[model samples]
Target chain A: MRTRSVVAYKGPSGASVEIVKQTFSSARPKPARRVSFLAGLHGDELEGVYLCFLLVQYLRRLKETEPGAFLGEVNVYPAVNPQALCHGSRLWPFFSVDMNRLMGEPAGNSLPAGACRELLADLKGCSDLAVDLHSSNQHLAELPQIRIVKDFEKKLLPLALQCNVDVIWVHPMAGVFESTLGYNLNRAKVPTLVMELGICLRIHRDFCSQILDGAIHLLHHAGVLNSSRRPRGEIKMPLVLKADQVGLVQAKRAGLFAGRVKLGDRVGKGDKIGDVVDPVRGETLEEVVSPFKGTIFTLRELPLIYEGAPLVRVALDGPDER
Target chain B: MGEAVSLYKNVWEKGHFVDTLSIVAGLHGDHLNGLHLVSLLSRFLQDVEDGRLPGFRIAGKIQLFPMVNIQAVMEGERLWSFDNLDLDLAFPGSSCGELADRLCNVLYKHTADSNYALLLDASEKRCVSIPHIQLLQPDRSLRRAARYLAGEIPGGGPDRFPGLGIVRELQPTPAFQLRLYNQWIENNVCALVLAGGRSAGIDPETNGALLANVVNFMLAVGVLAHATRKAEKGEARFYSLENERRVSASHPGLFLPEARVGESLRQGRKLGELRDIYSGETLEELFAPQDGLLLTLRDYPLVYQNETVATLLVEKERRWYWPFS
Candidate 1:
């Protein structure tokens, strides 16, 4: 096990922040393949942090118990934006800028941009494949899933299937995704997979364990770990989804939303999914319904919602599924 | 369909011309300074068109979009309340998208043929600023045009308005790719952002100075025939990203500002102090690193460690010409 600082910044008050990465590799001079795990890109997303912790613990145990099991290298970046993670903010506290958005940007005088440049340069060719883990914001709770842009769909779908997520969604690309770490890595031929699970600021142990198993399975499949060390269990096959096979439900009025459906519930069309009640007026302002027969992949976890706020996202399971 | 965003444009033209200048404001609902300045310019243009003003008259076409994001302004929010979408970042927008997107598309198309586009905006944070001009990746010709609009000779000194003296050349980042200024620049139009004041509030003196600056720019660019008053002159300062010194708080606490924006300060000047939220003891005091002009100061009290409390534009020595040296 080796730990190194990827980037460091000294503040005006004599304090400093550094992004560190831990590497575990075989005793041999060269490894078969190198795999990287990135988490805590957004400071509030804690699921990936916990998942990384679990993976690191497992790797330490495997390295001690079965030294021959490690055939390749595994790198874990537990927290990329340490300042934001410490402050529990979604953005870099100083500039109030989203560090994730600054990835792949040209190096600049700003600390955030400079840090991103260094991080990208370090991670560019360091691994044969990488996984960037994330969790939804405070407003929404997402089920375990992997979202891939359509341009990289063919190259990423097989790898994404290796992870035990609920759905593998291939959606059309938007301009905003061009600057993301996963998109840039994939563009650079590093084959990075973006995994989004659970919600921000909270950890779901079951989900973390599920992803931990999937990560180990991926390492074994990539020849980074011995087959004998693979977790004993059937890896769930995630449902493949396309952009059109998703339905979004939004609140029609501003009020407190009481969700009637769980995160992984299946419902029929026109089913009652939630109710937006106006507590002040003592009236149910909106009775949100499922737009299509599908499984709920994302639900509004926070009760206070404004008009036009997304309440739920459903992955259609019938004819829409391909 | 969502509620339609009505964009009102007031144009002043006296004769046929090949060049047209487009001025846009109110892209963000909270940027009321720009809105007020645009309104003042609109009324002034109307007077000139009606031959009510003594010396000024329309020479070329001048298009004034006083309020672009009407819904946001009505709600007193920075972004559209319904969608929470920033209209400023929806440039070259899609007609088939949301309300903000459609509005951006219409505005982009409407100003596609403009020779010069000026955007009126304010600080993105909860702070105030002195009226200044911001250029994003400006080319040589655009820089010269900006100087002319600022009422200064191509490389000469003595700016027309000290209130709008600061000119900051910004490097476009990924976040700026969707800005209207970037889109216009890509399309070969000279674009400039005239920003100052605070969001969601009005400063009479600042808006008045901004209005004067716009009028002078119009005169300099030949959009307006003549100037109504003598141009005010002062030395304009140009700064790049390197010239910016951002002072951040070292502790999380309630920040109490000791200085105001636009004030010139010496090195080690106290900018603010962070006080413990519960005990009310001074946690740390922030100071300016160099002699510079304060461009922005944090207005909101609550701040976390490493949060920027104030931004200063460092003053640099003027380059010595060969003969002068």
Candidate 2:
């Protein structure tokens, strides 16, 4: 195992943002393939960072205990935006730029600019498969999910299935996806899968363990590891939920939102999902109801909400059940 | 039935095809001055609507949004409850973005057609400031109208509210007022921001003075059919944001202020002192950068490094009658 640091950018304070790459190689390597794992693109999303750290630890232990057990190489970029991570901000603190949108753009001297170039350069001609992990906003708690571009679903689904996530969401090759690092890497002939789970600024231990085990299993599937140990959890087919039927519950009036249902709770149509109460008067102003009978996938963790702000997101039941 | 209802919607409306003035307040929940000012204006307009004021027909419609950040108002906080975002900072917001974005988008759409927009705000808790108006890129007519209104309001003195109007070149951030200025500029709307009051409680006299200024502004802009007072003549001191002075803490500790709001200070005057909270040792002394009027003073005892302790309105070379010593 070896560690290297690639200088991403020089901050205004003269501090350089160096993306640390920790690589574990197989002893029996003879022109072996390489798979990359990246996390913390959004500074505040640290679940993937913790998961990558654990994965690196696991791979390092495996490499030391039994040499020649793996086939190729595993590269991990644990925290990409150091400046943002410092302030627990989702966007780069100085310029307030979103790193995800800087892919394929000119690398300026601003926040995330040099970092993007360094990352793209590292992925070029050096990686075979890539996994980009992220988390929802701080107010949102999401189920462990894998998102794949629509065009790459056929080629990436089997690999995504190994991750043991709760859902597999396929997004079209349009909008913000075109500028994402996963999409950029995919266009570079490297298949990349995006994984999202839990909340920002906080680590979900169970999800981290699940993703770590999934990464190990993915390595085995990619012929990197020859171990017989499979992914720990049962390989259940994640629900292939569509984007249209996802009911978004928004606030009708500004108030303190108190959700009646917790994450992963199954609710029927017209059920009271939550209540928006006036913070000053202590009176319930609005009662939010579930539009479709389904499981609550992402609920607002924060209590404050305004009119038109989404308070809950429910994964709807399929047409057959509806 | 003791049921609660949200009836404050569309509080005041009059006239059609005439110029519209959109007034919004409570972007931060603890900013009570603007909320009180608009509340009084709404009641006054409601009286007109009920025919209580005979032969007084408003030429234009007034849209009064009393509290934009309702959750913040209820919680008695500065930022919105969801994500703790400052509503003022979220402007020209995204439709599919977070809570603050959506709220800003909604507000923008509501006031998109107004000919004039006013943002009323107050100083944060643990701080106090003299009432002032901030104008961004004001033209000759807007400047004249603003000055006309400023002359009518009786501030704590001749140089308090309506007395200090600053013309800012641009906002440093993508603030709500900046966005409104941009939107209004595109549609030829005059946008102005009036900041006043303290964090603790509402001052009715200040609200009344502000209300008179608004009424006078409406008359000056041909929004009101009748003028109540004679045209008073006085100059409203205008300065650029670049000329303002800010004193920040060099050390984090309990802050003891030496000057009061609206007080004048010469160069080398001590502003405040930062001391160790537990040890009670003096950490650092803050001093004035120039001879200026103290517009804002830090009220909170505990302060962190780099936090603003006071803001001074630097004196200009061109001076008018001196009212305060």
Candidate 3:
């Protein structure tokens, strides 16, 4: 595996800040199909970063065991927000701008500018495929999913769907989606898919491993590696849930919240997901309830509470858009 | 609901669109929002584009074009541009002003005509907040209507909505626009009413509902009687100009969200728990410390305790100014 660092910024520290890019299967290339993965643009979202690291390690070991494991080349930029990681944060320091949004902007134009020009140029040179890894900052958790821009299904869906995540988001140029590195590559006509796996803040071991498995599956599925991985079952595409129907119940008064729900429970209207109480005062302030009928996918585990803080999330079936 | 225009009348490349626009007087690109709303409202657009959006001559009322800010929209930003000239602030723009100012001038021209209502429809950027409609009354009836509009709309009214402790200071403040809408009402007076569904980038259904609220409001205020548009369920509240609330991550650490948008809670509810990436020591617990409706929760976790996680559209029945009696 080849790991090269692309300088993104030259700081007051005199040393240039570089994004580490790692590659597998470059030695005996066969009509090299370069599939690239990037992660950790937002300092706080860490799951994708873990996946990046795991995949790199996995590829390293696989290349040795089975030469075929090193089919086409896979490049990984494990940590894009090194500054954030250095401080244990999500966004690039000082700029605080979401780096994902900075993708595609010309080098040295914006805040940190597009200092990744040479790296991006090389990425364009390998315009076969690209994947940007990510996760929700907070308030949402789910099985790994893929977001593909509109009309790329024919060329990219098969590649994207192979990741083995639960849902596939099909849309045109969403906010973070459009400015993402994957999107920028796609704009250059490189087939691209954005993989969102697990939550941020920490690594969900199973979720993290899921991504590792997905990368290998992708290599096999792409015909680069002749692996025995099989499609588990018929792929399922979930219906998109709008933002509003999803609800969060925060506490009205302050207390310790003891949630009585798991991560993925079905929630109906008026479900008691948790409660807020003053332990010392020996009185309850409010009980978090689901206002609309939906399924509960994530619940806050923290006990110490405030007057108003989110406790539970419910995804409801929605009405017409307008 | 959004339209695109090239300020620079001629074709220009990305390299010099800015300096070039200044010279030749035009730039290209579209400033857009309401994507999630529009995608969700594909059916609604089918109605509008397919001629199903029925509207008759407003007797003598006027209709203005929507203003688009391409530059700001491109960067996935809410503000006007990198320099930050809000579309509202740059209104009534000078001929030689910046692109934002120029667009503002364009807006002033379309809206300058007397007797026009401005329904500024928007959404919370994250998710799980009330859909709000605002109206600032012109005393008595408008005041009553502002209250009523505030109450009638899903979220809150033109001004003085509960959730937003932060607000935009502009000429057509909700009441100002409300006054504009009712300018021809003679006795009713004009006012401003803003209704928001899902905030930017997240909830499409709520966003669609918010847009529908405006359309329904237009139908009602336009008094297209018997329009058959079902009234929305929630009431609109009001807030002051000083009440704009912003949401971001909490604790500058990785934001591992324990929930999705629109979760319910009691006071002292845990929104999510933050921990150090290496040490695993619990840092801060994101909690709801008040009684209210949550407007936004993080869709992406990675927070800084001070970072705005989720915002609540707080409504204390009495403390709030209920326009609808």
Candidate 4:
């Protein structure tokens, strides 16, 4: 029910790195439920940082009137990537390496490796569930959703699906199983989930709200909030697919490009996706085609494409699913 | 030539130390995907396409390699270094620019008269939290076509990051090459630019997919292929990365991925999961936003929080029938 902070580590320059924790919990023995969420793993991703900002603003105010009225703990730390955030980059300030990929390695060995070792040690020592927030950048647009790998599915799914998001991905494989904070929670047998909002290099009010509301709804489901804030829609179980093949379609000859498809459109197995035209030559270079039967997900935005630059991505369907 | 662990040393270091989920492993000449792609593209024009495209077959090929950050690549460092100054902040590339700039100049010269699409392959040790495709063009139609092309790449969209790209740096480069691609050639070839895939090494499938996508896209446009035709492989739901998506992991943990590139996904889908290599604690879950495709999947096990796990490119719900299925 209160905010908590712990020094995660110290920069070589000696600036203390801290784990800013926002907790909402009740007093008595097993008085209520609790939820924890963290964001800004990539310092350059400022949206989650802002969403966490939005969360703290409201949550802090709610505490005053209710006075720990919620059932359990609701903790949030807005920014986790300190160095990268300061410089507007994706990696840690000095390392120039990504922080997200090192979850599986030992702490001291990773950049920001010493991150809140003391704090996580303690949270793991007590916490029950956790969630991480993220935003998508330019080029890709998507609906917000929750991701719950297998082990956590037992406790997390039924409860996680309560968020306003659209689908839930349940994976139980090994590749998805290593080196992540959420993976750590599931390993500890603590239920956890990750919420993904597409593209946030800048803020999109709708996308931001989708993420914020989903988080709040999750809080309600977890019993962290005592009051009822009705969710807009029901969270559906996921419809999973395994992307099998990937390749690039190039321009046979150089020329101006005329794209025929839009994002999120369903394309037939052999539909015309676009065309290459020699502007001055007054002729068509080639007919860009769809290689498979699936939704057309993306296209290379640049018109002047090389002979082999990627043009569009086709999501292959299950042979029988179609 | 390498120790057992050195097969993917750069990736190992990045994956284990930097927290990079997936790595693009490039050995010696393999860093030439761009040239190879461009060459492949040049070859297909006369051989593959049945005379749909009208142009002189062999006038010239431009290799605009204007910027080669050899110091950075060799040292596993970022910020193109010359006598020892960073060049990313310094652009329009100087004629006498050292290391990176000179490399850029040389690159520009190679493609100085390319007369066609410009393909630039950039690989290094740096990674960003929010990743995207940087498109440069002044022409609206060209921009439109590229924007459509940009769709296949994740993170750069209207609802996403706003800027067109890290400043349109290609106009001059391509113009420089445009002159070259057109020199002595009856029909001038346009320049195409591309970068971004797993770094530190190579992901063959990702490379192949990126290549194949480009091929098919060209076919769709009627510039390369005589007709647009679907492959026998059926439709695939490749995960287009959510806006500028990057995978991250906590410190001091062994990172791993549960998903591979080109995997099908549903919203809330688990593309991969991570756990503590030592204690076996579950750390993170890499998921998909909606019914979409998976582009680049992580190949390594260890990770850091901000590292790119795998770019999970997603798409709207659709189904393609595979022969086996």
Candidate 5:
């Protein structure tokens, strides 16, 4: 395994935009399949960027010690949108647009546009399986999850089970489709799995290790790795959830939220989730209660909340299949 | 004089639950026109609530967020204190995001479910304009209702306020107006923005006109009983997005304006002039791109290359003042 850098786009001001890809591969005859992992499409989502680097380190050791333990080709795009990363903005700076929204647009129109173009061109025909890693926005912390278009569930569900994430979210069809990297690659017959963990602009080592381990598990399941690095636990099928009105709990008051329940915590109906407190008077304004018997899928990291703002996302627990 | 009551307070009150109108103003600290308008409304609504105004029936609730950005308002700055970010562009803010983000989310939450929302906005010190209504397009009845309210204002003929109303196709980004537009689409809140005047100084006429216009809008939206004093729809100019042209300086120099806001211009007329700041030699004459109304004129001169000098409203659709329609 070694590191490689390619100039994805050159800015008008002569600054070269690059994508650093760490590749772990076998030197022998053609590997079984090519899988790629990408992170930092949004500059602020740094969790996946760190995860990719850590995975690269693990892969390097695996290739050095047990060469046959790892099979096939694995490429990691540690940071895709460097301009946004440098500015700590969610979208590509200067262009002031979400690069994720213009993936299928003609490149060379602008810097970020050109980078998206180069990204698609680089990954085309190279990846049989693709995973786009991301973190939730700075406001909300999310449970480790795998998301795929709802239609691809049957084909990708078994593979998703191997990711070791806590939840499997089916992508809602309401949002932009063709403009996203996962959708574009999926349309091209490339199975792309979008994974999200933790919060944006920060690094969580535990989450990163879990994600890295999940990737290894998925690769091993694909017959690409022969390592004895067994799955951390029984590869249980995740509770597949859809974003709906039922799961969303909005704040009833505008104040600082003092949370009583954390992410991944299970609660019964009518359980106290949090309470909004008026910081000036130090009085509890309203108590937020859970409406279902479920596990918290997403929790607010920043306490300041407004009336009707989503306080928590709960994924209802289903009937036991044990 | 031992104790005093604060004029700056969150005075949100509810009347009969006929309709809910969330009136938000002063999102930016320095843009005081909105604050002034809110102040006027607070007094008027207080009068109506106290039964002081005869025949003025308060039909619905008025949620007044007079000082949405209080810290910024105190500092007299356009942006919130969090990283000096513009609150106007921090829409659909997050519950767990930064201060600006949470404020934005608060606004979104309040306005998302309202029957109607009125956001008051103003430019910073660089520019100024007459009080006018700005509507997001793809044409909803809200645009027509705003035009109706603009017509109802006291002193205005067909082309009176110059760009009396504007129809903009707002991008669905982080902007406050855009966030409100999203609510309009999903919840039918009929969101409208009353963007008028500029910072550095306040115009009483613009403030009064805005105050009247908001009241007129309440009547038109069925939040108040129709009265003879209500503004009648009249001949006025509505500028589409294309008509609003922001003319920037082509070269760095001293800029001299040949025309001010509310002035009409013919095609190819000199809008401004640029001269060498040091040498006092004529450099360039900025001309109107087309026949139009000057909506916003830059007050603070001393120009830089690419600095906006003025915004003209061209390619307009003007409605004639038909007294007996």
Candidate 6:
């Protein structure tokens, strides 16, 4: 096990922040391939951080029991935005800038920009495959899923299928995704999978363990783990959905939202999903309904919602629907 | 019924209205300085149209968009409170997209025919800046127009346009590509951003200065005619990206700034001090690294470690063939 500081910056007083990466490599002179696991890009999203922790723990045990089983290398960057993670905020505290949106740009003395550049430089050319894990924000709980841009869909879908996620959504490209780490890495010809699971600031143990199993399976598939030490598990095939196959339910009035449908629950069209009620007036402002016969993959966890806030996201039923 | 994002353009037209000058403000709802400045301009233009101002007249066409992000302004937020999306970053926008996107598209289309555009912008939230013109990824023609507006050209005298003597040229970052200023420039409109004051509020002094700057820009661009004063020739100080220095806090604590924006300072001058948040003990004193003008000062007292507290615009030194030069 080797830990290295990829980037360090001095604070105004004297304190320093460093982004560190831990690597576990095999004893063989030349291993099969290297895999990189990254989490905590947004400080608030902690599920991925716990998943990385689980992987680290499992790898440590494997190295202790049979060191030769670690065939290639596994690099874990558990916390990419250390300051944000420390502050428990979604953006870097200093600049309030999203580090994920600053990738592939010139590092021009700004702390967040420089940190992103340094992290990208460190990750590039260091691994054969990479997984950038994230979680939904405080408002919504997302099912374990992999979102791939249509541009990189062909390259990422096969690898995403190995991750045991509930869905593999291939969406069209937007300008906002251009600066993302996943987009930049894929553009550089290094295939990267972006896994989003659960909600921010909370850990779902079952979800973490499920993804951990898939990650280990991926390590073996990538030749990072020896065949003899391959983990046995059934990898679930994910429902592949296009951008238009998803239905979004938004609040029509500002009020308290009471969600009736749970995540992963299948519902028919016009099903009562939730209601926005004005407590002061003792009136139901709006009753939200499923737009199509589909499975609810994302549901709003927080009750207080604005008029246009998204309440639920459903994977619509179709020929491709499982 | 869906609420529409409506835009109101106050236009003043006169003889030979071939050249059009567009002035925009309130792209971010919280940035009140620009909104006030543009409102003042609108009133001034109305006065000119009414023949109230004896010496000033509308020579060409001038369009004033006093409140671009009306919804945000109404909500007292920097972005649209509904979606928290920045209208400024959704330029060349989608007509069929969200409210922000549709608003941006309408604004872009309305301003497409402008020969010159000036955006009155407030500085970032929790920060105040001296009134200055910012040119992002400026081409040769745009630079020439900015120089003219700043009174840097040979015909326009220096100090003629008070509060706009400083011109900063910046290289647009990747995220800047979506900004309205960048999009306008790409479409051949000579556009510049005048940033000052702070967000969510208005400062009379900063707004007054920005108003004068915009009026002068209109005058320079031949959109407004002045019969009394003759144009004088002088220089406008120009700074590149390297000239700006950002000073950040070393520790998370209460930041008390001793220096104000637009103040001239010598090397090693005290800029601010940082104290512990809980104990209130003085942790560090920030000092200027060189002789320059303090362009921006953080207005917020509570700052996290490594957050920028101030930015200084260092004066450029002329060099000769000598070794020191």
Which candidate number maximizes TM-score?
6
On the 0 to 100 scale, the lDDT of residue B34 in model 4 is 43
**Where does model 4 exceed 4 Å of error?**
A8-14, A27-31, A116-123, A137-139, A148-156, A170-177, A229-322, B1-325
Q: Write the residue-wise lDDT of candidate 4 on B114-151 in tens digits.
A: 32343444433332111223333334333333332332
Misplaced by over 4 Å in model 1 are A318-322, B1-116, B121-148, B152-170, B184-190, B195-207, B218-325
lDDT of 6 by residue, B77-188 (tens): 6766554356776778876554567678888998977999988888866888766778876666666666555532222222221345677886766567778888888888
Give the Å error, residue A190, model 2. 19
User: Compared with the true structure, what per-residue lDDT tens digits does model 4 show for residues A129-219?
Assistant: 7777765433334445566665566787776666666445555544323545667666776676776655546665765676677777777
| Residues A1-322, model 2: lDDT tens digits | 7888864443322245578888886666463778899988888998988998898888877877766777888888898877778888877664445677667654432224556767877976568888999998777888888888788888888889877788888766654455468888888889888999999989989888877877887888788787645445665567776566567778877778888898789988889988989877879998888877888878888776656677777777876434
Worst 10 contiguous positions by lDDT, candidate 1 chain B: B316-325
- The models' CA-based lDDT, in order, is 0.80, 0.72, 0.52, 0.48, 0.71, 0.80
For the predicted complex of model 2, DockQ is 0.09
lDDT of 6 by residue, A140-256 (tens): 899999999999988888889888899889999887787789888888887899999999999999889889988998888787887466667698888889998888787767788
Off by over 4 Å in 2: A1-140, A145-196, A199-203, A213-322, B1-14, B43-57, B82-85, B89-109, B124-126, B137-145, B152-155, B158-162, B169-188, B227-234, B315-325
CAPRI class of candidate 4: incorrect
Q: Which docking category, incorrect, acceptable, medium or high, applies to candidate 5?
A: incorrect
The alpha-carbon deviation from the true structure for residue B26 of candidate 2, after best TM-score superposition, in angstroms, is 2.1
lDDT by residue (A1-322, candidate 5, tens digit) is 6677753444423245678777888545788888899999889999998998887888888888888775688888888888788888777664446677777764423345556777887777568898999998866898889877777777777778888798998765534455688878877788888899999988988888878888888888887777775555665467787654227777766778888988889888899988888878878888888877788989988786655657888887753310
**Docking class of predicted structure 2:** incorrect
List clashing residue pairs in candidate 2: A71-A224, B126-B299
For model 6 chain A, the run of ten residues with the poorest summed lDDT:
A8-17
Quote the lDDT for B306 in model 6: 65
- Local error of candidate 2 at residue A169 (angstroms): 7.6
DockQ for the candidates, in order: 0.14, 0.09, 0.01, 0.01, 0.05, 0.20
CAPRI band for model 3: incorrect
How many times do residue backbones clash in model 5? 2
TM-score result, candidate 2: 0.61
